[model samples]
Structures are given as structure tokens and as C-alpha cells.
Target: MASSAAPAPPAPAPPTPSASSTTLSSDGIPTLLTIPALGIKAPIVVTGTDPDGVPETPPFDRPDEVGWYGRTASPGSQGASVIWGHLDTPKQTAVFLYLRDLRPGAQIQVARDDDTEATFTVERVATYPDDSFPSDLVYNDPGYPALRLITCGGGFDRATHAYLSTVIVFARLTAIGSSANGSGTGPS
Candidate 1:
């Protein structure tokens, strides 16, 4: 029988903007996240490290929202911004179930609270065990605006029934405003 469980990655590169794309000053408080390639459009929620110092995730009850690690730079800002979601929940597939499928050049859009929307382009995708997560790469400043979308993947230990790895999609700010249609990769 097929396993009924969630499975479970990192960075980016220099941004190359097309003539029609308008690059913005790296900054914004993201309120929404949209990935056309996965047909994912979800609200963004702010989350912080737990008491034990591990980064917190979105609540399981609200699987529809993506968690923005509040300690990191805001999305589209001149630093790394992290957003993550559940790959799947016991009751249903969650918002980021397909996060592992994102390929290079995929586009992600963030509607920010600043009355502006920032667009990002996927530069790379990766997966890593939860114990070996690249915290530096995900949390360190890239000296440019960057976005990291993460979800569970890798091996699932039957004993725990939890995914052992995280899938990461790293992208850099490519443009801002209405002109950034986020038209690169369509839904798979």
C-alpha cells in the first residue's frame, strides 16, 4: 500500500530582471504568498522560535497558512526571508505539499502589508535532514533580497511517521509591483 504521509531542502543567486520587470528597494512585510507552479496561494503568518530556541512552524490546525520566520528579514528585503508550511496533515494535504517539486526559475509572489507586492524567482531547490538543516544559508543575509520556501520531505521514519528532511526553495527578488506577473512556471 502507498504510504499516507508527508515527505520532505536551499539558495539563490544574483537576480536577473527583464526589461519589463521593475526591481524594488528590498523591503516589505509580507502578508500573502503565491506560487503559480504549485497553484499555491496562501496567507502568510508570522512565527518565531519556540522556548527551546528551535524555529516554530505554523500551527497544525491552521494548515492553510504559511509561517514567516519573524526573526529573519522581511520578504523582499536585503536579506534572507523564510516561509514554510506543512507538507501534509493527518486530515488532509497541506498548503506546501508540493514544495519539493519547485524547480529553478519558478516564480513566487508575496503581497506585502506595505501596499506593495514583491516577486521572487527560484534559483535552486534542495533537501536536507531536519538535524542537518542549513540554518546559516536559510537565516544568513545573502546581501540581496532572498526568499526560502521550506517544507518536510526526505525519508519518513516509520517509527515516528514524520518526515526526516526539509525541502527548500531558494529565490531572489527579481521584481516588484503589478508588472511582476509571476508567469514563469505554470502548475504541474
Candidate 2:
């Protein structure tokens, strides 16, 4: 007899870094990510993994907070930079609810702490069931510097009463600009 379980979704395509991409060093922590198309701008704090190997989740589990993985690629670096947030709350909108509406070629800008700015272009938007999330391919890919903006998707399962999918926006860095004085800072 055939099994009733659904097959796992295929892994996401490998990210391709643009020719103009740049690598960020230790000085580039605390980058700011802005999506003009979506009218979203927020500061990113560099953090490390907790004991359970999970990166910190802030502004998701708690509002009014910002955090990013310190061990991962900095905003301008040539690897995947993973950022996540919640979908909704009991009262307010969450950071990434609008992320699913982003189309290919949407503009995403990152301003480094040193005053440099890097711009990226969204390439795709995909949704995956939460049970079979492609974590390794999404977060561990080494081919190019990528950005994954993630949030909950799909309808809330009446049985579980929770969202069943994850919305992911894939983007690649395409432009970099430095401060006139070479300080690598930019206007907030």
C-alpha cells in the first residue's frame, strides 16, 4: 500500500552572489536593513547562538527588540544572512507579515555600522510547510551571500491552531557604497 504522507518539498536553489558584492568584517556589525518597496527599516543587532544551537529570536518573541546572528554573515558579507520574525500577535502587526507580498527585483538596503550601505534585489518568494523547513539549504549555503527574510505563512490549522507554513524572501546583494570620508557610515 502507498503511504499517505506528502513528499518533502525540494530544496531552494543556491543563491548567486552578484559581481559587485563586498565582504564585511568585524567592524560592520549592527547593520540596518531597509526595504523601500515595503517601507520597512530596522536596526540589526549581532548575536551568537544559544546553548540549543538556535540563533536568538528577538522582536519576534518580544516586541521592541532587534537581534541578528553574530557568527553569520554581516550585512555586506558574501554568505547567507538569515533574519526571522513573527507573523502576528495578539494585538499588533509583526515585522514580516508584509514580506510575502515582495516581488522579484524589490529593493533591499543595508547600512553598516561603519557608514557603508549595501543594496540588494529580491529574487524570489517561496513558502514551505513548517514541519519540513529547509533549514540547511536556506541558512548554510556557501555559494553566495544571500538574505532570507522569514515569517509564518499558510492558514492556521484548526487542529493545532498555528500557522502551517513559512514565508521566505530570497535576495542577493548587488550594490555597495561607502562614506565620502571612508568611514563607511550612512544617513539613518
Over 1-188, each residue of candidate 1 has an lDDT whose tens digit, in order, gives 01221112123332333233233443456788989999988999998766555667888888889988777767766677889799877677899888888899888898887666778899999998777878778877776778988888877777777788878889988866642443432211
**Local error of candidate 1 at 185, Å?**
19
lDDT of each: 0.73, 0.63
> For model 2, how does the per-residue alpha-carbon lDDT over 1-188 read when each residue is reduced to its tens digit?
00111122233343344453265443466556678887787666665555655555554445433455555566666677776666665456666668799999997877777777767789999988877877775667555556777667877765655677878788886766763332332212
Q: Report lDDT (Cα) of residue 157, candidate 1.
A: 77
- Pairs clashing within candidate 1: 7-152, 7-153, 8-152, 8-153, 8-154, 9-126, 9-127, 9-166, 9-167, 9-168
Q: Would you estimate the TM-scores of all the predictions?
A: 0.80, 0.74
Cα deviation in Å at residue 85, candidate 2?
2.1
Query: How many residue-pair clashes does candidate 2 contain?
Result: 8
Prediction 2 TM-score vs. true: 0.74
Model 1 gets an lDDT of: 0.73
